[model samples]
Target: MKIGIISDSHDNIDAIAKAVEILNNSNVDLTIHLGDIVSPFCFDWFKKLRSDFLGVFGNNDGEVLFLDKKSEGVLHKPPFEVEIDRKEFILMHEPFGIEKLKTQYDYVLYGHLHKVDIRKTDRGCIINPGELCGCLTKKRTMVILNTTDNQTQLITV
Candidate 1:
């Protein structure tokens, strides 16, 4: 299974649209948003995704109730744990205590710093797909992870 990961969209509709297109074209089995989505209106772009998506609230995500409604209850508070493809995964908006969580999950995915970080540890992998809005690093990025092999491709959209 291939999972698409995106984060820190910050309400850039254009970037979000592009990312959705890329993920759809890539035929990802699932899409994960690492938050900083900013506003509920952003879901207008996100709704185009072909695959189901899950998300965690970032510090900038203020309209929690509406976001949850917009996401149809797929959005949750940070540090959410999920099992996908028979692998344990933890999703969070902030990279807090990631090192400690690494031992517990097959994948530790988080976003907040608006930078791309991907590394394989002895236990699993740590991934941050960067900022989809390109507000900080001036580069829009996302990730596609193959669960079968645990390999990831960093995509700049």
Candidate 2:
């Protein structure tokens, strides 16, 4: 299965829209947003995702209740876990929490730092798709992860 990974959109609607188009064209099975989505209005771009989508709240996310209302049934508060195709995934907005359970999940995803990081470990892998907002590092990026073979491709927006 293919999974689309994104984070730190920071209310960049155009970038988010472009990324969604790419992910949809790739025929990803699902998409995961690591956080820093900012405002609830960004959910509109998220709603354009063609596959199943899920997200975790970031430090900047405001109006928790309203964000939930706009999430379209796929937002989790954070430090959430889910098992897919027997692979365990831990999702959060900050990488600090993931440091403690580094080797416990098949895939640990988080954003916060606005930098792309993909590392392999004895147990699994950790990935950060970078800042979709382009506020830092001046690059908007995302990732497509193939669960079957553990191959990841970084997409620059």
Whole-model lDDT, model 1: 0.93
Q: 1-157, model 2: which lDDT tens digit per residue?
A: 9999999999999999999999999999999998888889988778888899888999998777888888865788888899976899999888775666777888999999999999876666799999998998999999999989888999998
The residue-by-residue lDDT of candidate 1 on 42-135, one tens digit each, is 9988888999999899999999999999999999898999999999999999898988898889999999999999999776699999999998
Query: What is the TM-score (0 to 1) of candidate 1?
Result: 0.98
The weakest ten consecutive residues by lDDT in model 1 span 116-125
Off by over 4 Å in 2: 97-99
Please give the CA lDDT of all the candidate structures. 0.93, 0.88
After superposing candidate 1, which stretches have Cα over 4 Å from the reference? none
Model 2 lDDT, residue 59, Cα: 90
Give the TM-scores of the predictions, in the order they appear: 0.98, 0.95
Give me candidate 2's TM-score against the actual structure: 0.95
In the predicted model 1, the residue pairs found to clash are none
